[model samples]
Target: MKHEIRFIINGESRSLTVLSQQTLLEVLREDLGLTSPKHGCSTGECGACSVLLNGEVVNSCMVLAAEVDGADILTVEGLATDDELHPLQKSFIDHHGVQCGYCASGMLISAKALLNRTSRPHEEEIREALVGNLCRCGAYADIIKSIQVASRARR
Candidate 1:
């Protein structure tokens, strides 16, 4: 069964027909061609397919496309403006937070969600926000540092 869903993706209004069983990850990558959210783990353990659903970080693989009707979604592609990259994105590159790059999008989304809630989140808060995301390259140190730097930069 296919259902039509209308949602805001990367600040753009989108309406598309999606299979009832299709995950948001599938709809984003396969249907919408938004490939930043990688399909790392279909079971949602790896956190490689994270996106902000109405400003909250969620595992895209675990969210059904049909469930996002009228919701606002934010992918990594939406983080940047025309003039410059989002502070977290710049900090990620400068701090070497992205080692293998597989987890970069998800990490960025999670960090963005954290920074959205707290302008100056503590180190422990950053860790808690990213607890669900897994960096296979073991880049947690750099990732944390990047978030810290971005947090300070935002203020």
Candidate 2:
């Protein structure tokens, strides 16, 4: 069945038709052309499909597009404004947290969620927040450091 979903996408109001069984990842990539959320593990084990749903980090693959009606959605594309990267994005680049770029979007989103709740999170807290995410390239140290750097930059 098709359902009408109304939500704020990347800071803009949007309305779209989504199948009841369609994952938000599918809707975002197939319907909306937002390609950052990778289709790594469709089972939600991999954080490659992470996105900010109503300001919370969630695996897009685990959520139905019809479930987010009237909610706010923010993908990696929304992190920057007018060609300027978000502090976390800049920190990721500077700290070499991104490698191969497959997991970058999800990692960035997870880090953003962490930074939003605790602007100055400690190493442990950062690790805990990002526990759900996995980087196959072994960039965990740099990812953690990037979060720390962004946290300090926000101070």
Candidate 3:
């Protein structure tokens, strides 16, 4: 059955018709044309499909589109405002946290969620929060440093 859902995406309100079984990531990429959230391990094991659901980090690949009805969703593309990058995004560039760039979007969203809740997360907390995100380039140090830099800048 197709269901009509109203949700806020990237700070914009949208109404979409979606299948009950469709994942948010699929809907975002296929239906809405928001492709920043990559389709990695569709099983939610990979944080590559991470997004912010109501300001909390979630694996979009694991979330049903119907479940997000009337909810607020934020994709990596929403991080920038008026062509200005989010602090995390800027920090990632400044710290060279991106290599292959496949995991960058998810990592940025995860970091954004963490900073949203805690403006200044400790290094250990940052590491723990990002445990789900796997960067093939092994840029863990730079990623952590980027978050720290963003956190400091936000203070």
What are the models' TM-scores? Answer: 0.98, 0.97, 0.97
- Residue-level lDDT tens digits of model 2 in 66-94: 99999999999999999799999999999
lDDT of 1 by residue, 1-155 (tens): 98989999999999999998999999999999999999997887989999999988999999999999999999998999998999999999999999999999999999999988899999999999999999989999999999999999887
Residue pairs with backbone atoms closer than 3 Å in model 3 (clashes): none
Candidates in order have lDDT scores of: 0.94, 0.92, 0.92
- Number of colliding residue pairs in model 1: 0
* Candidate number of the best lDDT: 1
* Ranking 1 against 2 by lDDT, winner: 1
Clashes of 2: 0
**Clashes per model (N, Cα, C within 3 A):** 0, 0, 0
- In model 3, how many backbone clashes occur? 0
- List candidate 1 segments past 4 Å from native: none
Error of 3 at 108 (Å): 0.6
Which regions of candidate 2 fall more than 4 Å away from where they truly are?
none
Error of 1 at 70 (Å): 0.8
What is candidate 2's CA lDDT for residue 139? Answer: 89
